[model samples]
Target: MISRIAETGHAVGTAVGYRNLSKKGQRTVKAGLLLSPVLLWLVLYKYLALGYNVYLSFSEMSYTGEFSFVGLANWQQLANDPVFFQSLFNTVVLFATIPVSIAIALGIAILLNQQFPGNNAFRSLFFLPYITMMVAIAVIWQYMFKTDGGVINYFLLQLGVIESNISWFGDSTWALVAIFAIQVWKTVGFYIVILLAGLQTIPEQVYQVAKIDGATRLQRFLYLTLPLLKSTIGVCMLVGIVISFRLFDLILVLTNGGPGNGTEILLTWIYKQAFLHGNFGYAAALSVVMIALAVVVALIGRNLQRSSHL
Candidate 1:
């Protein structure tokens, strides 16, 4: 009887343990069901594709599209390419607009923050360009900057600024300036909206207290508004940097990186390499370089933001 009782107790303990494990298993299965789709998506679309691209960067493909390892040949070619260097230079020039854009946007944001009749309408008007189609904008700007019978040239000629129609897109020296004008025009609205949101987040009571203290407009802006908006400004700066690097459509549609490759940039060059020249491996290498540069810019921006806190 004692042996039989001991055996029964062991059996009960096993049943209890199995019941506990069953409950735990059910919970785990529910969690897996919830997370599996997201995991599958990332693994299939994002992680696997990134890995494949990296592999392609180091390998060359035959006409049959069979990839074979080419070691550092692509990188060596990229390093020696003169057009690559010119593209890099143009990218830097485009990036120079970031601070300028931010400054102008800050001013616009401040103006929009004030109360006025039809304020919302004016705000939308300023922000319209950012949401407009780039292809359409590029085509419009091409006509606006045309060499002969262009509206811009007509105005300049009327003002006695130049003797003849200036080839804005066809001249190497002026091509980038035209690009800068369009870029600033299209992007300023976005920064303004972001900054205006930031401005609205600042407490009205803080500004009221400044006004009560007899602070002048400039002093209040310098001491209160600018200091409080530092984080927002930093974010805008980072966004601007990324946009400058990703500037393909505007360059492609506007100049096609023309005027003797005057406006060539990283993305434009990568597109040309991958699609036009069938240099997939080289283009992949360029893409990696572009990603690295963007990462470096992000790190630098983060460091600056952190240091500002100190």
Candidate 2:
């Protein structure tokens, strides 16, 4: 009788364990089923597309959909292409806006962090440009930077900043400057908002303690604020780098890489090669280069962020 009872108890315990395991397996399957659609979409649209693009970089495709494996011909062409180097240089130059925008945004954010009348209104006003359509902003800026009767030129003339009207978009020298100015104006507001949030994360008691220690405002900002805000600044730098690289639409609407491709960056040049010039293989190679550069920059940024924390 004792042996029978023990056997019965063992059987019931095994059954309970099996039931629990079966339920766990079922839940796992359900979760996978729920996530399968999104996973499939990403596989098809992102990873597969990326792999195909890499393949295309090694192959040539004509305008009439004629495809042929060209091996490294496109890359060799890219190595000898002056326009590719020029676009690379131009893209590097666009990074100049990152530091300038960060400085301006940080300054504004600091000022706005203090208690002041109409502070929220000022923030909203500054952030207005960020919410506006990029193409619309580009169009408005194009008109403002017009050679004749533009608001900017008129103001410059009135203030004796320039002796004559300047062709902002038409001139190679000033076209890039115009692009930089518009980019900074459009992005600074967003940076300001981001920096403001970073600033708020810092406890007010820290500032009070600094003041008690006889620290001047500038000293406190330099020694206290900047050190604590390092991570936030790193985030801003990475964001700025990404934004600078994705400047195709703004450049397209503003200069169309005009003034004899003077303002041409990687994306604009890629668009021209693939769509206008029908050199899809070469364009794909350029894209690969751009992606590699972006990855390198992002990795560097990540390392820097990690080092700051250390």
lDDT of each: 0.86, 0.88
Measured by TM-score, the strongest candidate is 2
Per-residue alpha-carbon lDDT of candidate 1 for residues 221-289, written as tens digits (9 for 90 to 100): 999888778778878878887667536888889889998898898889999998898899998888888
lDDT string, candidate 2, 102-209, tens digits: 899999999999999999999999999888988898889889999988999999999999999998887877999989888899899989998999999999999999
**Worst ten-residue run, lDDT, model 2?**
301-310
Superposed model 2: Cα runs more than 4 Å off: 1-39, 308-310
lDDT of 2 at 78: 96
- For model 2, name the residue pairs that clash: none
* Cα distance off (Å), candidate 2, residue 163: 2.1
Model 2: residue 307 alpha-carbon error in angstroms: 3.8
After TM-score superposition, what is the CA distance of residue 178 in candidate 2 from its true location, in Å?
Answer: 0.5
Which one is best on lDDT?
2
